[model samples]
Target: MIKDELRRGIIHENPILVLALGLCPSLAVSTSLQNGFGMGMAATFVLACSNVIISSMRRIIPDKVRIPCFIVVIAAFVTMVQLIMKAYLPALDKQLGIFVPLIVVNCIILGRAEAFASKNSISKSLVDGIVIGLGFTFSLCILSIIREILGSNKLLGLKFFPGYEPMTIFILAPGGFFTIAFVMAVVRYLGNRRKGA
Candidate 1:
C-alpha cells in the first residue's frame, strides 16, 4: 500500500541516510537550511515529474536505450525547474549554482527511474517519487540543522547565542561526512532496537 511505501521511503530507504544516494548535493547544499530546502524541493520536482513521464512511457521505450530516455526525461524537468528558479528565486539559483544543473545525473532520480519507475505503474511510480523526494528533503533539512547550528551558531540567520564561537569545520567536506555518519549510526541503532523488541 501507499502508506507502507511512504514509511519505507522516510525510514527504511531514505535516499541519503539509508540508500546513500545523492550524497554530493546533500553535502554541498546542506550548510544552510535555506539551501538544503531549496535544493531538496528542486530535486523533488524533477524526480516526481520524471518518474510519472518515465512510467507512462516505459513500455514504448526500447529496453536497450531506456537509460538514455530516462535521462532525457529527467533533464527536461530539471531544466524547467532551473528556469523557474532563476525567474522567481534568483539568489537561491545563484547559490545552488552548478548543483542545480547537475541534478541531471543525480543517482536518486536516475536510480528510481531505473529501479522503480520503469517497472511500476504510473501511480505507484509517482507515489514513490513523492515519498522518496520527501525523504531526501527531510534528511537534508536535518543535516542542515546540525551544520548550521554548530558551524554558524545560528538558525535561519538568527543568532542562538551572542559571541559564541562557531565550529567552522561543520561547513567543510569532512564535517559533512562526520555529521552524516553520526546520524546514520543513530538511525541504525534505533532500527535495531525496534526490531529486537
Candidate 2:
C-alpha cells in the first residue's frame, strides 16, 4: 500500500507533470536550480503542514465552510513559510517573491485537502503531502536543469561550458511551455511503451 502511494505520487499522479496542479509557479520560478528547489521546498512544507491540519479537522469542518477553512489553514502555513524564508533564506525569498504566499491557493494543496487529506487518516495525509510535494520538487528540478543548462549555459549560476552561447528562449515562458509539453509527451510515451510490453 505504501509503495503504491509512493509510486503514484512520484509518477502516476505527479502534481505538476502528471496531474498538472501547479504550473504557474513552476514555470515562473524554475529558471534556476536554486529557485526551483526553493519554491518546491516552500510549497512542500506548506502542503505537508496543511494536510495534517485538514486531516485532523476533517470531522468537525462543516462541509459548507470547509473550503474557506482549508484556505485558512493553508494560508496560515504559507505565512509560516514566508516568515521562515524571510529570516533564513532571504535571497531565495526574494527570488520566489509572491509565489511563496501564493501557495495558499495552490490547487495541489486544496485538491489534496478535498480529495485525499480530508478523507484519509492523518498519517496517510501526511505521507501524501510529502510524497506529492517531492513529486512537485522533482518536476521543478527537471525544468530548472534543462532551462539553466541550455537557456543560460549555467547550472546553479556557474557556467558549465565556458563561452557557450545560451539559447535565451529556454529561460522564457515559451521555453517553459515547450519543455513541459515535451516532457509530458515523453512521459506519456514511456508509459504507453511500458503498458505495451
- The lDDT per prediction is 0.90, 0.88
What lDDT is obtained when candidate 1 is compared to the true structure? 0.90
Give the least accurate 10-residue stretch of model 1, judged by summed lDDT.
93-102
51-165 in candidate 1: lDDT tens per residue? 9999999999999999888888888888888898899988877877667887897899999999999999999899999999989999999999999989999888788778889
Each model's TM-score, in the order given? Answer: 0.93, 0.92
Give the total clashing residue pairs for model 2: 0
Candidate 2 Cα outliers beyond 4 Å, as residue runs: 88-98
Over 4-112, each residue of candidate 2 has an lDDT whose tens digit, in order, gives 8778888999998888888988888889998898888878888888999999999999999999999888888788778988999888778887788778767888999
